[model samples]
Target: MAKRGEALRAAHLRYAPRKTGSGALHCFVLDCSASMLARGQLALAKGLLIALFDRARGERVEVALICFGGARAELRFGPAVPRWWNERWIEPVGAGGGTPLEAGLARASQLLERAARRDPGRARHLWLFSDGRTTQFPARPAHADHVTVVDCEASALRLGRCRALAQAWDGACIDADAMLA
Candidate 1:
């Protein structure tokens, strides 16, 4: 090659490292039911969600929330940066209704699927807080990269359905207290 010296001249110094923690989505499915209201579980769950949203914000990870109760589920936030989350936004989250776990999961799955279509390489995580009060079962979403289930059920007779759901999803299962810890 006659450009041996040209190769050396063409080399310019540029320093960059692989980017990480960007384009990540954290989908939280919070169970806001009468059972959750019994022992302030709903409050605890909301507190945890706020903390999680803050952490995700610090990491530049997008956060989304789905609250299920009253036989309905709704997305409270989004699969975008949680820049708009604050105490006012967190205050209006009401409780006292039937636990619609399946509906929450279904909505989350839809969000994950849509996100996958938009950004295939983006990381997606699902976090569910439930008392395992429902008999309905929802399948693990194929679009989610990971899932974590927290059983908010605090009683003498535990159904262990939250753990079962976690097992089915091939994800980690922990208690509400454990989650805080």
Candidate 2:
């Protein structure tokens, strides 16, 4: 089987650019809840995020990051320099606190809003990496052009939720574990 990177590269190559006149902006909302520590998924997610960032850079797409774990989410990276997507600054993410999907989604939406305000012509893409066990969903933002949910859990229940969430948002869903295969 192809590696995750290869798979992602292939998928990306197959992606058709949105017809919007604005440039593309890719935002990654990563779940850092303690459960991610169980199967080294956090590390893998971080690595994949960096790889995506590299691809975004190569394509000159703007990139940003938002991390959620505890009661709240944080904008760990930026709506600024796309070059700041370096993995070195990504702290070791561990699981423990409850998943704050609503918070994370809200923050991501806000970031995208800011980006749009700065450049309304830019296309917006959101990538969410999570275990899909969250209790809440933030109201979907109206501006997101596309969303991709990456499920990191190995259990059926979690995967189901991931798929459900993707469907609810009319977005693509990916099983991170399977992608790694």
How high is each candidate's TM-score?
A: 0.84, 0.80
lDDT of each: 0.85, 0.78
Q: How would you encode candidate 2's per-residue C-alpha lDDT over 92-168 as one tens digit per residue? A: 54457878998889898888888777777788999999877776766666678898999887653454777788889
Candidate 1 Cα errors over 4 Å, as ranges: 1-21
Segments in model 2 whose C-alpha atoms lie over 4 Å from true places: 1-22, 91-94, 156-159
Error of 2 at 63 (Å): 0.6
Question: How far is 40's C-alpha from truth in model 1 (Å)?
Answer: 1.2
Error of 2 at 48 (Å): 0.9
lDDT of 2 at 166: 87
